[model samples]
Target: MTKPDPIPARLAALKTTPTPELKKQWRELFETEPPSFNRRYLESRLAYRIQELAYGGLKPETVKRLEALGEQLDGGNITLRRIRADRDRPIVGTRLIREWQGVQHVVTVTAGGFEWQGRPYQSLSAVARQITGTRWNGWTFFGLKNHRRSA
Candidate 1:
């Protein structure tokens, strides 16, 4: 007889498990009280913990590389890290196309900033201003903001 894998079943049960049960599992796995986050967060963290324990975690080299990358991103400043993390900048080489006044406008995300009509712009809001001659929220103008209602 061969041993069956229990990870898949455990992960599947997370969706149907009650919040209290999920918290209990979190406490047992993490050996600490879970943060006061939502049920989805609890389930997701618990799932990751279960799988990490069953298999393994990232190698030391991978952890070091990720830390180096983070330092490069924010120079180890916690506030800058949070701000950069929250900003959903589009990937480089992406083309953002919008139509205004019956004319099509295209902006290309570059490594340094954005390029529109063969001109470089430091920020999307600046690009928006050039496009519309008025102040506008770039994310909203580009339709990237998540339209979710907060309770």
Candidate 2:
């Protein structure tokens, strides 16, 4: 029986035969860059296999890993910096304004045409200026509170 062709030879032969010239070119491009080469090829191959298992639509564990990968690629952590920058920008006539009538004398100040929590605001700067009586941190002030529901 013949032995199976090795992966590198198979990959390198994709464009043409596995001749010395092709092998040399493939080695030059990929041998010294094993991480990049393996990541480019192996990640997709494995991710696709995982996706196929997930396509069964019932494997919760597999689905979770795929979702995690999606988050990493989307740079969810880095996006936080972008969100802070966005919240600091001034809004121009885009958000709805509401005045609070309680004893606190604070304005509810909805819709500053920006989003601090998941919900959109009228304007982050305007909301900050109006709520705290001083230009305060909009992201901190407007963060959503997850209150536990009473049983």
Candidate 3:
């Protein structure tokens, strides 16, 4: 019998595939085509080609879907609290004192003005709003600087 044309040569190329994933791909695609003498090998070759084609030409939609799916599979949410600090003594007026972490600074509040570590500020409320926003906890009036005691 006459030997068939050299399709087997094409199929033989699948043997050089370096990975198991490529081997599996060959198995799946080879199953679809008609049986040549080297059908098993050709299947692998076809699978490799398919894999190479797929890897080389990924669509944006596929990339986005994969990213979304990955996020869905392994994802979580987080809540963040604004960093704050306490003062050894309160400044005058409706001042809100706070300290930012990772910095050597103290903020003080007063009715007429605010101070950050003694730097004068326009208004205590403005300073408070800057450090802690509109609503922050833990501030109250206790006593004025005892001027009479100095006398």
Candidate 4:
């Protein structure tokens, strides 16, 4: 039987590798200056690179499909850094519309917060409260999240 790959052990060792050595590995793997993140970042990225090379990275068709999807998601402006930046936050320039009491309201996501009818609010919940005149979880009201269970 084929022996198990030794890459996993090496990846684990990366957690304890010296910062300088990790930087060297990073350079060899990516052929660029390592980002100025932290030791854990270096180790994780290096590990992924090692495994990707030993095995194979994503298929060409998969890459193309993902690129097409990214373009559709972000109008062809998607990048790794951009996706990471927007991962935890809503995509800027996206519009959210909700109807309350026969009136439809639109909110646009901004860098700082969400804009509702020409006013900026820090959170969707705030806008929901303003619109409903009652406490609410904005995501649920916006249909972005499931309704909260009543206890």
Candidate 5:
């Protein structure tokens, strides 16, 4: 007879397992401290880890291809990579709209850069400069900056 499948049971247990126990399991499986993210993040990552261990992770070539795509998006700039990694970076094909002095401006996000007023710019700051005739922080001018709450 074939051996029973343990993967299903393992994945199911993650749903009911206590957060501390999940962290312990994460330590054992990932060999690192668990991130300070919420319980749902832990559960999902633990489930993926269990499945990855049981089956396998992505192939090396696939990983390489993904990395290459990421590099193309960030153009190998460390600062750009950090910004691109941010959740606030607008996705490709997003349209950012802003009105300056009662004149409406629209910018389209592209795979390589941004387009505004029939011109392509490498950075949103350049588009903002063109709109306002002054230098501006793209994220702030575009209202993408993360706002922190005070206690």
Candidate 6:
């Protein structure tokens, strides 16, 4: 004679059962109102609850350690990230393309700085000035800044 695999069998049955039936089962199993979760969520949680009843839940020491770690991390104020110039720049090996005065300008992103016309340059504005013969914000020239370019 083989023993019935109750947990898995119940989980499988829970999948096909309707919401009301699952709710009734929940009431019988837990003697409480079922949460308004979806069918799959209900089944999975119910399956876990059934297994927990049959076996056991998290160890007391594990729960205590987790709670202690949570308390340690729960600082009252939210930490703000500082804005950095390096963070504002693109990652290395990225290529940025722009068209000005019916001409296409290409700039390669590098660890040192932006590269243009087979030469390494320190800034995008410098590259833009070289291309346009006028002073311009490197970020604005490259459309990386929050300003709209004039048509």
Predicted model with the maximum lDDT: 5
Q: List the residue pairs that clash in candidate 4.
A: none
TM-score of 4: 0.48
For model 5, the run of ten residues with the poorest summed lDDT = 142-151
**Per-candidate TM vs. native?**
0.52, 0.20, 0.20, 0.48, 0.53, 0.45
How would the candidate models be sorted by TM-score, starting from the highest?
A: 5, 1, 4, 6, 3, 2
In model 2, the runs with Cα more than 4 Å from the true position are 1-122, 144-151
Ranking 5 against 6 by lDDT, winner: 5
**What is candidate 5's lDDT per residue for 1-151, written digit by digit as tens?**
9999999999998999999999999999999999866788899999999999999999999999999987787767888755644445577989999989999999999877899988899888989888887667887788866652211
Which of the two candidates, 3 or 6, achieves a greater lDDT against the reference? 6
Candidate 6's C-alpha runs over 4 A off are: 1-4, 75-151
Candidate 1, residues 62-120, lDDT tens digits: the string is 99999998788778898885456345567799899889889899999887788999999
Q: Which stretches of candidate 4 lie over 4 Å from their true place?
A: 77-151
* Model 6 agreement with the true structure over 1-151: per-residue lDDT tens digits: 9998777777778878988998888887788998765577678778888888888887899998888876565432233111245666788998989999999999999998989999999888889889887667888888888742321
Scored against the true structure, residue 55 in model 1 reaches a CA lDDT of 95
Per-residue error for 27 in candidate 3, Å, reads 24
Give the lDDT of residue 119 in candidate 1. Answer: 97
Number of clashes in every candidate structure?
0, 11, 4, 0, 0, 1
Q: How do the residues 79-117 of candidate 3 rate in per-residue lDDT, one tens digit apiece?
A: 211111113334364444345454344555554445665
lDDT of 2 by residue, 1-151 (tens): 9977455454443444333444344455445432323233443443343444434444799888988986765557767655654564434433333333442322333333554334454545556555555554454444422321211
Q: Identify the superior model by lDDT, candidate 2 or candidate 3.
A: 3
- Estimate every model's Cα lDDT from 0 to 1: 0.82, 0.46, 0.47, 0.82, 0.84, 0.79
Say which candidate scores most in TM-score: 5
- Estimate, for each residue in 92-139, the C-alpha lDDT of model 4 and write its tens digit: 998989999999999999998799989999888999988987667788
